[model samples]
Target: MNVLLLLLILSFASTIQCDIHTNRIEDTLSTEANDTNTLCKDHLQVPEKVRIDLYYESLCPYCKQFYVKELAPVVQKLMNYIELYTYPFGHAQMKKNDNKTTFECQHGPTECYGNGLHACAIQYLPKMSEYVPFNTCLMEKWSTDKDAEQCGQRLHLNAEPIRTCANSDEAINLVIYYAQETEKLKNMSYVPYTVINHKVMDPETDLIDSVCATFEKPPQECKK
Candidate 1:
């Protein structure tokens, strides 16, 4: 009897934990929007550092690796000097099939559950004051589970509304818009095309070096 009771308790705890994680991201994102004291102010006043807009697909491994391991941390450090934006390559298609209980990799959009959701996260900006935390939570939870709803709960978000928002046209359209605008910004035909202050650069070579040199003050400065 005790063992059965313990198992039930554990299952309940796990469910609760997932819900918390999912909602925490949204809550954090809301806070980020109002806390203007941070370095991510739009139309930045500073001039010395370059303005960067990154056009990327979440499915792209390079973008995932760069962002998870390198880019996000760099941005956090140089938040004052840089402006960042993200666009997913598969945003439009994802929305068309978002209500799906299971992903359709053969005919339907592939990123319906992946990068598509991240783009949806952008909608909370400037009003909810929780965009950053929500985004961070999403990124952190990436790959663990394909379902954003599950991930959102794990992030400690207000899971009730996020679940509703997850299935809405509003979320889908927002992601699509993010993709379309990103394509316009840099003519981005590739998954991880990076534009630094109007200068287009490659992530594997040029962008990586620039990000490192500018943010970390590399030991050997290239002439460029």
Candidate 2:
């Protein structure tokens, strides 16, 4: 009886181990096989150490427009010389839409509800780090049409985690840290401020002109 019990326990443990191993292999294979590209408006040809930090809230229509109309084109032209980063502000606390108390669709272009989708985006950053083109697509969808479900599905993201993060103090503070630290390091006094090669640029002129001049390969670039 004792021998039988021991044998049964060993068998169960072995089965569990096998199952775990199989699942892990499947996960790895799935991830490895995924080769999707992310689409961003600004596809900067970034050189190492030349980083750009853009601060804006997801709900801010102005930010969305700037990204689509200006930043995306500039980045695409200067892809070899610019590295882009994001800082989200304003709707950090997941304020619900006035009409939809449970979850509000605040803007037409973005697919967010001031809820978990935002948090989920941050949480899943690890899985998404490699997919640059998708980030652009997600942002583009959110900017033009506020369909959180469609946007999430478009990016292959889960909604639950994003909502959870939007309400989380830790997540808020983390985003805050990124914004504040960026401001401090780059001596930024405003949002949409671009730091290029240690110079603080006005979002309107300096940043735009700098990117253009770099692509134009002008020996003497205009300083805005």
Candidate 3:
């Protein structure tokens, strides 16, 4: 009789222990699931993009160098993190004579035409992914009509729309709009003027470093 009683006690204790162990395991799993959910939410949050404004003319050598050498290469890597605005009018004056408007560029008539091409590209492309490469190619050489068409072809883009736009009054209007935006900068006396988040960036500073400094959480490319 005593043996049977002891056996019963042992069985009861074992069942209680098993239940406690199972409860602990469930609690542990619940805690782990909550932690995973929290981590996922943090990981999925999007970061704010940096704003960059470039004021330059098509024919300026310094502007061309900056666009082709510095800006274009880094743009693709940082595209996700940047909002780029390009203004192609630099020291270009607009004069209206008896319902006809004429422009005189600092670099002369050829430059005015080149600036129109740039404005047209921006108007037609509208996306940095498309326009940046096209502009980079154009800036690397003389921005002639043939050069524009060639760049468009090299990028696998249809050049007809861009060509049509360049010859239209719409292109002139776009250039005029850029000229107005350029005029807003206080005491601006230079081409290739770069603004990062509304502040003028120093020309001597490394472009990447200057851009990375503005980010609250710099990207992986910035680390490299």
Choose the strongest candidate by lDDT.
Answer: 3
Give per-residue CA lDDT, model 2, range 45-68, as digits (tens). 212223465655555566656656
Error of 2 at 166 (Å): 2.5
Return the candidate ranking by TM-score, descending: 3, 1, 2
Candidate 1, poorest ten consecutive residues by summed lDDT: 37-46
What is the number of backbone collisions in each predicted candidate, taken in the order shown?
30, 35, 0
Candidate 2 Cα errors over 4 Å, as ranges: 1-49, 75-80, 90-123, 126-146, 157-160, 182-189, 206-209, 212-224
TM-score of model number 1:
0.55
Error of 2 at 151 (Å): 1.6
lDDT of 3 by residue, 79-172 (tens): 8778788999888888889987789998999899889888988988988999999989999888888998899889999877877888889888
Most accurate candidate by TM-score: 3
- Please give each candidate's TM-score: 0.55, 0.47, 0.79
Worst 10 residues of 3 by lDDT: 37-46
Q: Distance (Å) between predicted and true CA of 142, model 1?
A: 4.5
lDDT of 3: 0.82
